[model samples]
Target: MTGLGEDVPQTAGAIWRRTVPVWAGLTALLVATLSLAYVPMGRFGIVVSLGIAAAKAGLVVVFFMQLRKPDPLLRLTAFASLIFVAFLLTIIFAEVLTRAPPTRPGTVMPRSAPDMPGLGQRAF
Candidate 1:
């Protein structure tokens, strides 16, 4: 009768059982990421790594942070933030691609001083 009115507490075993799948999933994802690091895809490797990282982040946010059970607005906000980040990245890449090639420093020095009609002889 002592616990009649109170909410039944979940047993530690039940909690572990429920969380075990999540733990396994995270571990598997970690292993996959590690394996992906060794595969050579040239430039596409960056895209693949970023995709895997995004998946891992999504799992953490959805399960560990319990975002899926919360109000819809929270999910919307998270998506909006991701969209903003993508926009920022697009702008950065655009600027990088359009920029002129870098020139070596100190490669070009003034060969001779500019001529000055009004000034007297220049000092070396």
Candidate 2:
């Protein structure tokens, strides 16, 4: 029994049995990520790579960090953090998607531009 009077398994064998599958799942995810990199998906590759990384991170957090254990405050904190991150990412994505594309490739202006009223030389 746990300190909270819960009948959670405290045995080493039970913990090992639970953690081993998580480790194997993480390894499989790593292999999938590496293999996907070789495929020529172009723009979609970024989404796939990020998705795999998020999966691996989730496994590490839930299993290794033991977030699934009976602790309401800890679980609420984790959920709130995830929500905050999602909100931030949504704002960033919206800003990026709505921006206008650059018209010129470089900073230097064209040679045809007139000089300033007082200055005779071109600004370029």
Clashes of each: 0, 0
**lDDT, candidates in the order shown:** 0.76, 0.84
Clashing pairs in 2: none
Tell me the tens digit of each residue's lDDT in model 1 across 1-124. Answer: 4433235457899778867887888888899889989999899999988987888887888776667654677778888988999999999999999876557564543335554334575443
Error of 1 at 100 (Å): 1.1
Q: Candidate 2's residue-wise lDDT over 29-119, tens digit each?
A: 9999989989999999999999999999999998877786877888898899999999999999999998666565664545544543447
Worst 10 residues of 1 by lDDT: 109-118
Best by TM-score: 2
TM-score of 2: 0.61
Cα error, candidate 1, residue 11 (Å): 5.9
